[model samples]
Target: MIKQTIAATAIATASAAVSAAPLTLEVFNPGEAAIFPVASVLVKGQQDAVLIDAQFSRGEAQKLVQQIKASGKRLTTVYVSHGDPDFYFGLDVIKAAFPDAKIIATPGTIAAMEKKAAAKVAYWGPILKQHAPQSIVMPQALQGDTIKLEGESLKIEGLTGATPDRTFVWIPAIKAVAGGVVLFNGLHVWTADTQTVESRKQWLSTLDRIAALKPATVVPGHFAPGVAMTPDSIAYTADYLRKFETAISQSADSAALIAAMKTAYPAAGLESALAISAKVAKGEMKW
Candidate 1:
């Protein structure tokens, strides 16, 4: 009788632990209204939450603050997955709201942000105007590759990849992926930053790595409204990159390349991204 009681107790304890740490994901995307259709994911456990990426504008970050407050979970960490302005520019707002939440990012990401944050702010500050962040809030370098939430692990992948700064978070317990700048859906893929052919190839390789995980849920860092967060977005991004490469080779100038992409993706939003990417690819514009 004693042995049976001990076994039952252990089993019950294990089950309760599992139940307590079933991480749930809530995504916030400001659709097309904001400059970029960037996404911020709030990963929630029973009592704590970890936010992935702060949005681009102050207004959007304020919205995220409201969402987190509504979730009733204590915001423990804010992990900026990428160093881009769209990913971390709004950190000031988030940090102001949750002063105690740890703001962190990979060492590589921190390095990139440190290098470019000033220039990015200078460029977009006027355009964003009231929506711009009051000031940039840089994230501390995360020591390791995993963040713990309610005893569950949120693994940060791609540190060893070609671009260590551009990483994604993989939640193994829930079999979901919070794909950062490495993935896009329902919009023109941003190729301006990855101008070189080799860089684009490495990005495609990263997408393949995400697919290999076979995640049940995939949240893109940027996506159009109404687009489902699924593995299909991975396939869409890979295909768009290939088409973009082909257009780059065939077109004689940026205009031609832009025209080709528009013909291919007539309904796609974010023509600005396509235009700039084509210009950079064709050597007409220096990014």
Candidate 2:
């Protein structure tokens, strides 16, 4: 009986080893000219892979599609974190490349997309001009809180604060977290939706939840190339939110607020995000 048990255990161990495939995480940063450094991470297994976010605009998405193809892995899934146009606008490009890949997002995210799809398209149309996608490709509603690939499964946690709805993906095997738009590494986060004090507080609470994950590596939605996506991404975002709130309270005018923030984060380009936040704060623009 003891010999039989030992033989069974060895067989199981061997099977597990054969099924385990090495996974690699790579970030594709769409550098300058992009309002922010939108990062798309490719979580590649030996046979298949998953993409974190589609990208912000036409050019970025085109570059990302090429990067994915270069990876030489079958793309099975593209998980969108939120309804934000930047994350999904380039989805069509990816779909064209991997015809079988399913774009999935939470129901709430889909709703938000439906709510803002037209508005976002109008907003970006003039900016992107001919580079814009002819039409948006909405994501299919994710069935559950996890994405199951062949030999691996990624846990998804729906979160709010950064946006009306955002999803974070946790990969246990790699001890990594794809934080979507909830975290920003070395970039000024979009505060247009959180102009009020209450909204900013909620944003802080959301950051706390992500921090609790203790991810060894974090893939922030917007991050500069070569920047390490560690737990510091969460800290940086939290600190920026607090500073933005303080700047709002202390600055005498919109220009003053923008100046103060720029002075604080000189290297953090993309003044467009700050302009949007200022417009929203002054009641000049919708939240």
Candidate 3:
């Protein structure tokens, strides 16, 4: 396990180092859905540090907080992979842990959160009641594809499939990527955001590009952390997506396609897989 690695364990030794950052991963509960391992990276510099995704729920976020409680370092930044409630709602629960932690989210995500505040009260307010979310802030709107925080550099790329407005972060240094959509594990990739045929084309092609990167580690919005993005993993994701396009081109009815694909998918949680596949494939949702 990486926990046993000298670099991974030496976090404590860098406690007093002149220049170093403290990084760690935290797991979050994905409600009734599969438990996704959400990573909360802590970058410690001097007497402060930053945290990534809190968790999916208040309870799970607390667990993350408890783990970092001993760090005794100040939490400085909080970057949300996207605007999904599943990723940032827990911020309310761990606000105290990072009293000054500024919530960093894309401008689109910030807008989404604002637009949904009224309709999705339960998802947003609960975080305040639960994690208290010290403050919700927008990312500086990092101009280029790459962004630098503290000293860590990140590449921001986006896709419009799972979520209408979502982007993933690529950390070159760690050879790791954090995608907002749950592309791995068992969750059927949500095609809810796809609204047009052309858009769907862009989405699929974009995912292919990310996979081609073949990251050493992948952290999607959901799913426990993946050690290495194997060719099988990337291929399966692409294949899963292509199946939808194929079913669409074939003009297969959603109902029948869903049933047939279900039998073929066999795997748990794939019922929606076929349905979503057909819907987006046919451009029913436009994208």
What's the C-alpha lDDT at position 209 in model 1?
Answer: 92
| Every model's TM-score | 0.91, 0.85, 0.68
Q: Best by lDDT, which number?
A: 1
Put down candidate 2 lDDT per residue, 1-287, tens digits, no spaces.
00011111121111001112356787776565465346677888887889888877777788788778887889999988878887888887888878899998888889989999999888878977876777889889888678876577788875333454767788877778888877776656678866679877877887787788777788777665445667889898999998988888888777888888888888774567777786677667776
Clashes of each: 0, 0, 11
lDDT of each: 0.82, 0.73, 0.52
TM-score: model 2 vs. ground truth: 0.85
User: Per-residue lDDT of 138-213 in model 3, one digit per residue for the tens?
Assistant: 3444344555555766666773344435676666655566665535444344555554567667766766767777
Ranked by lDDT, the better of candidates 1 and 2 is 1
Prediction 3 global C-alpha lDDT:
0.52
Error of 1 at 268 (Å): 1.0
| Cα error of candidate 1 at position 26, Å | 0.5
The sequence of per-residue lDDT tens digits that candidate 1 reaches over residues 66-184 is: 88898899999999999888899889999999999999999999999899989888888998899888888888888878999989999999988889999999999988899988888
